[model samples]
Target: MNETIARLMNHRSVRKYTSRPVERERLETIISAAQMASSSSNVQAYTAIAVTDPQLKDKLAGLAGDQPYIRECPVFLVWCADLSRLKAAAERHASDKPSYEGAAENFVVATVDAALASQNAAVAAESLGLGIVYIGGVRNDIAAVSEALNLPDYVYPVFGMCVGYPDPEHGAGIRPRLPLETVLHMNGYSAEQSGRGVQTYDETTVRYISDRTGGRRTAPWSKLMADKLTAPSRLHMKSFLESKGFNKE
Candidate 1:
């Protein structure tokens, strides 16, 4: 495989980061690459806020489930699914009010746009010898995070990313994934084919978790997922999204 493909294959989340700051020029380059990611109809309805201030990062770390890496990383990026810009654009170009600014379909578009751009940024950062981790805990207290970030209506923080040089002493390794056949379908999907390798995958993950935890935790993938499904998740998402002027439709 080519270097790019190989790099993609070796992707892993890095939680422990060095104190070395990510230079602004390099961060800009990464964002520029992120902007090049494919967008739905070229809407590019997203914004990335790079958090550098130590106190701000600390507060964000607490908001994001107290993730230490968020504060430790040189740059913490908050990727927002932002339709506020689109709404402004519409008002500027044609009407005073946007007809479908809060449409559920547009929410999906913005969220996906943010995700795609963030992944592109991740790849770009990795290419530049930086390590990164995505923080989904930003959604744990979505309202607080939005308030902290000063997000506007029609904008929401989809996720956060911690970026910096990896701490070699505590570097993470690539984890195993489901076999290619399990995910790669010929054309139409086949549930049986997709599920055929899960048992083996569960075993593989059981071992991986054991190794990672020094044998203290050995829960299989299915069991862990089952527990997660049984737990109360972010049940406030519906109301929170509505409050932020998304998914009114």
Candidate 2:
């Protein structure tokens, strides 16, 4: 496998982090690397807020479904899909009054760019002997998060990242992923083959969980997935986007 692939394959979410702080310079390097990731159409419609204050971290943790790890991590970064800059640019260009159609499209592009960039930063942090976790729960209280960060219209928080040194006693090893065949398809699609692979991967995941926790209560991967999809996860996302001034047509 390629070197980058090797790094990616070794990736796992780290929840427990040591109290040691990541230095300012190293944090800057990681942020710089994130900025280098490819943006959609070079619009670079993304912004990141590096958070270090303990009080703010605690408040953010509350907004993120009370995830203590959000407060414990040494460095927290909130990635935002920001279309405000482009809107300003258009105004400066004396272009015809802007519309939310492009803003909506640009929001998606910015989200994709921000996610890619943040993952790159996560990889870099891990490579430097740091533990990192992506906090998707930031969306749990989208309005509060936006208000807390003082985000303006046309800017939405995509996700947050927590980075720190790994906790030796509590942190675990790499968790198993679904089998490759389940995810990788040839030129054309084959449902039967993929289904078989999913079944096998479900068993693999069950066994991995059983071993890791030394418990027999592990649910099969299929059931776990069903539980997720069976309920409405992003039901309010459309309205939330609209509230953020993104009119998705």
Best by lDDT: 1
lDDT (10s digit) by residue, model 2, range 1-249: 998899888887888898899999889888888888898788888898999999999999999989998999988999998888988888878577755534556667878988888977888888788888889998988888999999998899999998999888886778777778878888988898889988998888888888877986688889999999998885777788888778655
* Distance from true location, Cα of 80 in model 1, Å: 0.2
Can you give the lDDT of residue 50 in candidate 1?
Answer: 96
Q: All candidates: CA RMSD in angstroms?
A: 1.2, 1.7
Q: Please provide TM-scores, in order, for all candidate models, with all chains considered together.
A: 0.97, 0.93
Query: How much does candidate 1 score in TM-score?
Result: 0.97
Off by over 4 Å in 1: 96-98
Candidate 1, residues 1-249, lDDT tens digits: the string is: 999999999999999987788999999999999999999999999999999999999998998899889989999999999999988888888795547989999999999999999999999999999999999999999999999999999999999999999888997778999978888999799899877777788899999999999999998887888999999999998999999899899
**lDDT of each candidate versus the true structure:** 0.93, 0.85
Clashes of each: 0, 0
